[model samples]
Target: MIQDKFKRWIAGAAAVSCFMGAISAGAAASSNKLPFNDIAGSFAKDAIVRLYNKEILSGTTESTFSPKKSVTRAEFVIILDRVLGIEPVHSAINPFKDVSEKAWYYDAVTAAVQVGLADGTGAHTFEPAKAVTRQEAAVLLVRALNQTGINGSTSAYVDEEEIASWADSAVGAVRTLGLMSGDENDQFRPSDGMSRQEMAAVIDRVLQNVKWAAALNKQSNATRIQMGWQYGQTTAQFEQSVFQAKVTTLSPRWFFFDPNGVVADNADQSLVTWASKNKRQIWAMVGNRSNQEVTHQNLSNVTYRGKVVSQLTSYVQKYGLKGLNIDFENLAPADRASMTAFITELSTQLHKIGAVVSVCVSPDLGSDWTDGFDYQALGAVADYIVMMAYDEHWSTSPKAGSVSSMPYVNNAVTTLLKVVSAKKVILALPYYNRDWTIAKDGSVIASELTLVEQDSLVRKRALRPTWDAAVQQYTVSYQLNTLKHQIWVEDGRSLAAKYKTVMDHNLAGLAYWYMGGASPDIYTSLSNAERFYGLSFD
Candidate 1:
């Protein structure tokens, strides 16, 4: 009997009134300046006034709201249609037998039916004049918002047992979201008719929730501005380099693994304070030191994962951090699923506190070292995916070349694009270079050089640097201490070329490996509006 009643309520509630011409007709006939006399000091007055101003609801007859009167099914449907800005869909035949072709709500009902917002009562009867029950209202509003309530064991109402099974989930969803509430005694009275004033309050809450959700989505899609901070860098050292970088976001290497879940290093507590004062966002990076054993021991266990998530959440709340950058690298191939699971769990916890998640992943085509990173799954959970597109030619490489060569970067980016969205991918650039010493016995040794050192070495040694167009970096070779030395330099020209690829791909943004090593000219070139994606960081 209860199920049958719920079915009838849904069928009748879903039947929409013809809304085609009612909106403009109501608009022309009503004015927000015309206030309701009875609701002057009522609790729902503010909500009623707000809806009236938005042209979503009107008084029963211009100056009277009839606040205590039950709202009819057709009236509730029309209010929802107006507030949701659902345009009317004209139909030659009405879906419900009781609905008349000439009725003012005829088009509104058709519009609601078209969007699946409301339906007919029986096989063909709409029963348009029936008063809307609280549960029916909850179901209609949840459907209009494109959500289905998640079934749960517990209910938000004290009289949960009285709610029809079909409407239980909708009731809970509406209540949890603060879109709808119980009466003074905390009784839902799901089957009871909803009054005009109660309906007004519900609509107001829905409008506010929709607007807030849109703002959060916009923030999630905004372009990222990321800069890496080297571990152990002093407050003064980080700040000095940051002044030159002129970035809006920072990822300080401040958190790492410890026997006690995770440990945070302030590096400089003042740096975090300074970042907040300057309106900069900090995504505190948590690394596993690329240790396979450490990652497995911590992330694979359910208890350990929970503990780490709790610690990270507490840290973020304490410091008012904007985001988390998970950099747990060098995991065993078997730990792939575990790593993805950890990220999923961490993201869920952090998102509850309104913080973003970014995952730093190594670039790979099909290499074993990067096979452990489930790119697709991580991309789904994280707000951004940082592709460390450097070290193509590492310090241990037999032959020295650009750390991130053009060919290597192009291939890595193209492959990653196949898995992740361009909007969520951040391309990391090398801000320094490698210095290689060639042995006389036809062997090579490599070391890193800052941008300033690259220039000094070239001029002081009178070594004429030649541009390697294929690789897109400057290269030079000279003798030092009886052994020949070769240098691959990353400067303004090389940085600009790489940045162009970022623009060509329409990537989210650029990131630097570390702050201190780059030339000042690199910043000058990046700030140019004409050449570099029209960016003016200053």
Candidate 2:
């Protein structure tokens, strides 16, 4: 089936996303030797020896490496430059007065400064000889790696209150990257100068990090390895954005209106031609969302089911379509056997002509609305079985909670994987959020929120949004008039956590619900998600 070839391509993409280590692959191995007499039995001896072999660390003299010496700002910058393979671009106009052209490390310092790896202490003074603080080294390493969008707070450290205002995120990033650790007292001494031995160990960890991030990173091929949902009416909205490049497959709500097997008004026929020209797989959606009587009637009668399949087959041939998304929702429980028969029949007919079949079902946890779905039967026939993996809390919900809490989603996926093939399942995620307003009497009211609107509301209400690690969603609470409002917002962090569910289960990919709702930054988050998850999907 060429699944092996596809997996190999994905592996290659993942390898490229990881940080390339200081050592080049295929290079001859060097002999490990202790440069300093005092480091023979030291805890950092191995790290010191490795960096020395890479020429990233050096001795104070011919016979002894200064294992106890404090690393200066200039020395750290030079080490970072070498380890990251940053070529020092020689510029004539010096940014700092203290750094002279004749200085031995002038090129390294200038290169570091140009790329924002290092900066002056104050008043244009580049304190080259000053000892590099733990915080300073963290910032330098983060910059050297070109990592961005890292959010951190002092609360993560015991002495976090001591961390400088500017170094909070830097310290957080370094800690998250596993390059830095706390002391015996469980304190991150941000102001303390880093010793030469400690520097060596950190750099050694950075070298190992290259392998770690690469190993976990899986590059996704949007065409075969990823999927997303679209509203046919807003095809023009997402067709031109960077978000389009992040998704491999598009399932537009193309045909979900009448029970007579007719396509919906929301269906955009032109998307079929556009998808063909762009080499994208367009799966035309077909189903009934709320009208249970129509769905029951269509599935119960053999004559009507045949007609429905006939109409869909015609649409596929006429449009040059890639596949079909069966989104029959809210059907009666009595239609269980009928539902399975319909899917089996549709798959059999569709596969004859090479068009794929994907069935979207509500999250199954013994709920009445989802009891009729025969996951085992559908999973066997359908090419892809999508789990509408959200709606823990809807607009008319009683309590305010996460729309798709990570724990709930994880449990649902875990259970589904037991009955379905992981390779054929897709987890559908919500791109929007719900805001709940609570009156003093404990009554709750909710409204839908786009990510952009959520951010604006956070600012307008002057509320601090706190990340709930358990759920992977953000929570903000505030008082307006006599009512207390609480919003559990969804953004990049929550989305990445949701995507992890798919990866953890080795599922086909994810399907985002309705485009044109998320902010522009969500696109960057999705594109650069490899960095966050340390994954690669080619």
TM-score for all models, in order of appearance: 0.57, 0.65
Error of 2 at 410 (Å): 0.6
Write down the worst ten-residue block by lDDT for model 1. Answer: 529-538
Cα lDDT of all candidates, in order?
0.71, 0.70
User: For every model in order, what is the number of clashing pairs?
Assistant: 17, 11
What tens-digit string does per-residue lDDT give for candidate 2 at 1-538? 1223323322332233111112222222322344555677667899987765655555564445567778888878877655544444343334355776567666667555543456778634688878899999988877666554665555757898998988888898887777887888878999999998899899888767656334323344433255666653366765654144466677777676466655454556677667667767878788687789888877888988888888787788777788899887787889999899989988888898999999988778788888889998899989999988788887888787888898888887888888899989998888777888997778799988866677777657655555566887768788878688887777655676677667667788777786666666565445434332333211
lDDT of 1: 0.71
The clash tally of candidate 2 reads 11
- Model 2 accuracy (lDDT, Cα): 0.70
RMSD of candidate 2 to the true fold? 12.6
